[model samples]
Target: MPLFGQAAVDQLLEVLDLEQVDAAAFVGESPQTGAQRVFGGQVAGQALVAAGRTVERDRFVHSLHGYFVRPGDPTEPIRFQVETIRDGRSFSVRRSTAQQHGKTIFFMSASFQVREEGLDHHSPAPLDDVPGPDDVPTMLDWVQRYPSRAGIFASAPQAVDVRYVGVPGWVPPGDRVASEEQRVWMRINGTLPDDPLIHACALTYASDLSLLDSVLSVHGEVWGPGGVIGASLDHALWLHRPFRADEWFLYDCTSPSASGSRGLAMGRMFTRDGRHIASAGQEGLLRRIGERKQ
Candidate 1:
């Protein structure tokens, strides 16, 4: 298999690095992919970056909740506005908002905390139960095998290595559906800086990529054409343990319910050695059109 190359990875990092126009205000630009709307992950990550920039270096983000207020325009620059909520001795809270053309596109409230010893008991990940990342096929490989099924994942320069445990929702009705149980092994395609905030921000970006896929899998649905169409409405994340985004981690996701044209999915992140690191959840607007869905 060919390598994804560091070029794409570098591009991701650059995107995360925002320009500080003023205190508590930052400007960010999107990749010129020429997509219809800005990716939800990019805006979320950028909002986090803006919030992280205003806080002291000692504190690290532990949790974040964000809402996609409006669709973003990729061709325009996003302005991030951050407000200091509170900064206690052990904890700090910040609110970050992303605006395009003076209108809010995304908003996030993040909490940061200092390291403190605490009781820890987390269930081990099923590493032995599933195949290692090396044993699975890459997104490029999946696209190669199912060109008809590959939607936007068809190109190269993949920044993150996403290896699905089984067939993804994008695949037509298959032997197994990930919606019942969606797990993917992923990591940055290249090494990242040693900054904890950067790692957290990068993972924040990756977290949004597939959380919604589980909802699609619930009905064995695919994207585009006759499949179900959806848009993420909100996202939430919590970091329980430290982790490096450049290393391999497993995202085990599942959908609790799908009603009123809305679907909810939750996921947990675990290190390869089975340490539970983080948890992520999202809800989206899903609508089925055409005869393929029925």
Candidate 2:
């Protein structure tokens, strides 16, 4: 069974409730890879679950900082060890380390604050004049259109629905261009519970998709047979407000720098109404075939 499927993730969520410290130790193993690595979103989501379990229901997570150290093996179970850094009247802090085979694969620190009204100021949301997810073609539809490159989409986990305004590189150019920015509509494929922590985790998982590719867009390198190799090195996110994961969210991404075989990209996630819900930044290893020697 796929570790990233809806049923698998749902089952994993049941085993890894954040309230009990022992539940934090719950790890979902991949039946295919047999590697002990945990899913990046899973770790982020589970960590948020762990932190949320400790705080009052009214106080939601406002921000989180995490680092990915190594690829988790799916075969082995990941142990989530939690640390209560501080507890205060208005704020609480917690740190978690996800370990596999006794090796730390990921580390995270999250802060929660009691809900309070405050002055708000933010830049106007970007113009989403483009078509919405339903208006655009589903990623799966595109994959089927090009059966030869179906493996790429086939390998992706099915927890989220991805609709690309610009077709992925693997597909033959059917009205596509290499732009510095990429737009996509994303949301949980299924109805997610109202738990804010679950929404945050779902966002974290969705954040990683296509972020690095934004960097590739700058160089006109889309994923294909001759495309460059890219993998995320580090990911950071800041949640600004509360939102639903099951609803369509717009992700606008841009690449500011690509040098020394590394690319940096930043993203802003917004609700359909243009409210800024969260911000994300990532740096990754981008290397093109044959270009590495030159």
Candidate 3:
């Protein structure tokens, strides 16, 4: 089986290391993961890391809004420019732009706040009596069973270990129609340094995975050889509490709406112990094409 081992996780951590080019300007590199375009989650996470690097440690990121301006070229390095929008006593706002080949490819706005006691409340955890990661089918198991159909996944350098709770939506449907909801258990493949930003960035990378797949489930669009075509248009995330990305987290995802060649999916992240930690939403371009003739 292909390994998403310690080396892979370290490679991701290395990708987040940014170099300061000038005042408020930083440089980041894309890992050669053999993807056609840069992963949107990587850009979002790096931008947030850059923004956080410029702020005080006591202030943590509470929320972020980002747009995918253009598909990034994975072969080249990206430059991040951060703008300090505000720095009040309790809140700081920052804007980050990622540029490559002299063009803007992505941008994001993030807000950070100093920790304080507040009236805390959250929606009930959606997961119930679900099997844990050890009991689920890992991505490698799927790839091994249907190599011709899921070969592309095997080629990518995966930094996170993913175990789907049920058959993936992208798998060619048999008697069952695709489901509206999807669940997966995932965690960073290896231990990370004790840094909250690292954990946040790791989760940020994991967030983009399978979000649009929820949309695919609704349309019965499997991914491979002229299947569904899609790209994330915009993504938003709210961090509710501190959590370790290296530990197992259940990602419960669902597609609530699809219209005009677009789909909206939301996900809630919960610890194995059922602590609701974060919420995410994304809208993506989703279209179907005719099956390929072999």
Worst 10 residues of 3 by lDDT: 168-177
RMSD of each: 2.5, 3.3, 2.7
- TM-score for all models, in order of appearance: 0.94, 0.86, 0.94
Q: Output the worst ten-in-a-row residue range by lDDT, candidate 2.
A: 28-37
Q: In candidate 1, which residue pairs get closer than 3 Å at backbone N, Cα or C atoms, i.e. clash? A: none
Task: In model 1, state the lDDT of residue 91.
Answer: 95
Ranking by TM-score: 1, 3, 2
Candidate 1 on 9-68: residue-level lDDT in tens?
A: 888888899999999999999887646898898899999999999989999999999999
lDDT of 3: 0.85
Report the lDDT tens digits of candidate 3 across residue range 1-294: 344789888888988888888879999998875779998989999998899898989898888999999999989989999999999999999999999989999999999999899798777766666788999899888878777777547777678898888666557555225777878898999999898888888888899987777777776667655576678999999999999999999998999999888899999999988888999999998766663422
Model 3 TM-score?
Answer: 0.94
Please give the CA lDDT of all the candidate structures. Answer: 0.87, 0.72, 0.85
Q: How do these models rank on lDDT, best leading?
A: 1, 3, 2
Q: After best superposition, candidate 3 residue 123: deviation in angstroms?
A: 2.3
Model 2: residue 5 alpha-carbon error in angstroms: 10
